[model samples]
Target: MRRGGRERSMGFFEHLDEMRGTLIKSAIVFAIFAALIGYFMKEFNEVLLWPLHYVQAEKPTLVLELGTTTVMEGFNVVIQMCFLGGFILAAPFILFFVGQFVAPALTDHELRMVLPLVFMAGLLFLIGASFSFFLLVPSTIRVSIEINELLGYTLRWTPGSYYSLLTWLVLGVGAAFEFPLLIVLLVYMGVITTAFLRKYRRHAIVVIFIIAAVVTPTPDPVTQTLFAAPLYILFELAVFAGARVEKKRNERLRAP
Candidate 1:
């Protein structure tokens, strides 16, 4: 019993040590990417400003001139963008280190399942972010300008504020795309099955629309629809996928 307690304590401390090492490695990789991205400020700036260009191309009437509100806001934007760029560039390594720390405790089947799910989640997030960057942001910008114009207000945007909005829009939309994965995971874990999803589908969609309304940076119908539509579609897909997984799980259970 004493030996067992000592072994358990050692295992706990070992895991903590592993997590610490993984974090240190991730930090190192992130720092390297931060330096590289910071050095390429011009390119990064161009990419960051593409949504503005996208809006301008479609709307000649919109007025947009981003300014700094503070003495150091310019540098602050630079640092923030650089840090974001670094995280984006180093995402794979970061995921890897995180996975390494978690993988040891998982069973072989769970290990196999986790990696592909992680990859899919990451891929879906990037797709959602790109969708926001290229389409949603421009539409939001255009709609916001139109609404402000209707209210008799002139457009004056600060660089810091604009960039912050851009970041949130991308991240929020990216996160919005991740909900279906959660449903699928829950199905796999047998917490709830496809029937539950189907039964509550209407309520789920209403909640999704509410979430979309809240999450969309601009409260335009178009953006909200864009957010809600895919979410509903993904929920449908999740239902089908969940049904299939449930069938297989039952089959395996009955086989033995």
Candidate 2:
């Protein structure tokens, strides 16, 4: 029995080593994907610009300005877009790789909970990203254009700056959308209870607004409200989900 216990302990270390190998493999895959994205930057840049282009329905051409100071600066913009595109494109695979790696350490019940949560997180993130791209970006753009026109300034945006801002906003929203998933996972792990979440609802509202303030690039309160409101709603949803999960767990325990 002592020998068996020692072997089990060694197996635990072996599992850790396997997890390390999985992470290393995932990193290598990401590097290769990044390289491929770098090679096809123009195509990716065009795709990224589509949201902006579609929004400017009246304008035949959207002009972006850059300093003629150095030709290399232009190439740098492409590289930036490539990296952004690569990360977005590789997100699903990255999640899958991470899931597969950690899944071995989780119990079957935990695995069932985690897999669904992972997929839901991915979906929610994409929805938030699309919302930012389709709604928030265009609104911000129109506001900027109107403000610039009033100031007698031409809308001379740099491609590098433009893509950077757009990508940042989209990714930020996407990451923010995972708030519910995180909360639910915490509840599942018993790190937090549904009652605790409910009790903190008021504080959460204030925190959500603060988060929104930090997230929004536009200084407008409207944009901040838009982001914050949805996040708060998601928080409520998470609380309800946790309550259900907790109730189900209690019922199982009480059963024969």
For model 1, state the Cα shift of residue 199 in Å.
Answer: 1.7
Candidate 1 at residue 9, lDDT? Answer: 33
**Which residues of candidate 1, in runs, are more than 4 Å off?**
1-17
What value of lDDT does candidate 1 attain over all alpha carbons?
A: 0.84
Separately for all candidates shown, the number of backbone clashes (residues 3 or more apart, or on different chains) is 0, 0
lDDT of model number 2: 0.78
lDDT of 1 by residue, 45-73 (tens): 88889988887877787677888878999
TM-score of each: 0.90, 0.81
- Determine which window of 10 residues in candidate 2 has minimal summed lDDT: 1-10
State residue 152's C-alpha deviation in candidate 2, in Å: 1.9
Clashing pairs in 2: none
